[model samples]
Target: MARVKQKGGLIGCGFFAHNHLHAWQEIEGAEIVALCDRDEKRLKEAGEKFGIANLYTDAAKMLASEKLDFVDIATTVATHRPLVELAAKAGVAVICQKPFAETLSDAQAMVDACKTADVPLMVHENFRWQSPIRAVRAVLDAGTLGDIFWGRVSFRSAYDVFSGQPYLATEERFIIQDLGIHILDIARFLFGDVAQLSATTRRVNPAIRGEDVATILLDHETGATSICDCSYATQQPEELFPQTLVEIDGSKGTLRLGANYQMIVHADGQTQTLDVSPKLHAWARRPWHNIQESVFNIERHWTDCLNSGHEPETSGADNLKTMALVFAAYESAAADQKAIDVRRMA
Candidate 1:
């Protein structure tokens, strides 16, 4: 039997969208048949580079003309809700990029739209899909580290991200909104849903308009407390750019995911060290490869879910919790680091 590929259309040809485009090419059960971007130059360039023929400057025209099974929305936060709603209105499934909406109400509206349209909607929150992160998750699932009680998810680097995405430097909410969202999602992925959250932020980079550093404290529903901290201002001897380091302490023992993808687990009176690294795909580069591979992983998961009629692990409904944590962090920071009830916000 031949596998029928799901037809996909990609919107927003931007810096990070290229990774989505490249990863879609490698996906087994999906193909990006049409491209849409308001910028004609970027749309044409992406179509030429990827050998896509169907191109459009308007998304509605593309959605109405093409019989797409799903739309991969790689647009910025400002456009996510509209694009997702458009796709849902067309009865097409949607896989939108992270920071899925500007607010919880908007996120819920998008989710409701898809639900009413009977279409699957997934948020492309891919950090938890990284191979190294999955490895740590596997350990937890296998009961290797029993009864997780405490953890820390940290991503500290002095990398020059502005060189690639200059707009990030100008966002009113930088680290927590752009970077810490992923770290916070990972905390939820590893520990569980958050019940309470408190945070503090700092503007280390005077040139930027938003905070470049943030630390968040999460009280998980499972009674596990965790910290998610992200910084682009730290000048360290070893720069672990794009790498997420983790520490997990459980009833039996502890686990540490250090730099260079090193994961150490100690349990039952024994310590085990493992190398957990992401695969470098043909179209991926170093440092960014971890994230690139996760793009592939999550997209592959989308295709599988579409085929199997399974709800994605990071569906819009699920992402609301993560987004709640993001907003709650900001609220906490603004309120003098006071704890905010995450469930109420979500």
Candidate 2:
């Protein structure tokens, strides 16, 4: 097969856009051709920093005029559907940021639009791509743990996410929607589809309207049970471990992902810690460098999928299950810890 030189167009120039731009530039067989944002200042800044000459304040205008192979939608959750629909209609493949849409209906529409257009759509759910978590997944798949029965994927910290993205604090969905969605998706990725979910939510922080903390119980289709918990209230040394750690207990052994990218596997009376961090790139900056790396990993996967004609690990169709899990968590929490079947929402 000939190597496909895929051109990229980025939508929504925000804090996350710089990371995407840097990653796209570093990846082979991909080039960012243009950037679009409703804010002219942000658009211009990103365009100037990334050396992208073509810029647009309107996505539709950019989609119509630009000759691009794929579009990266880094905008907020509310804007994802329309932009993805536009990109799909324009015959352009799409890589969208997480929480694919505010509602399952909108998410389904986005997926259906891409299918109708015969274009590929991938959700940028990067948690599963994180190196330490990926290593944990590898260990489980290798059967070192053997027939895992229970697990926990937790994220809790006082990171002040509201200061950077204040909209998160005021949203009706709260931390579960913002942070729990990623953790839920990670559980779905590591385990199989969730059969049922029961959850409890709390607004520990007085300032937020939605629950800042949630604990969810997941019944996997494989008879493995898991807990997915998330919070913006808990304080940690670095705030990194609050959510990314994974603990799994299998019939043969146990596995744990600790803070600072440590993966410990214990089986057959033997224990080992895996050195998981790969070399960091020059542009990868602080606070959440691991997260930045994961974003790059997902971007590279997207580029490879476009080049090799394969579906990405985080394909639109696959992400529907993840999104359904998110909604199921909310429904479970709202109903006072009632077990909610995931398929009911579908």
Among all windows of 10 consecutive residues in model 2, the one with the lowest summed lDDT is 235-244
- Once superposed on the true structure, which residue ranges of model 2 sit more than 4 Å away at CA? 1-4, 241-243
Residue 338, candidate 2: how far off, in angstroms? 0.7
Q: Scored by CA lDDT, what does every candidate get?
A: 0.95, 0.87
Best by lDDT: 1
TM-score of structure candidate 1: 0.99
Candidate 2 lDDT (Cα, 0 to 1)? 0.87
RMSD, candidate 1, Å: 0.7
Best by TM-score: 1
Task: Tell me the number of clashing residue pairs for each predicted model.
Answer: 0, 4
lDDT of 2 by residue, 94-131 (tens): 99998898888898999999999999999999989887
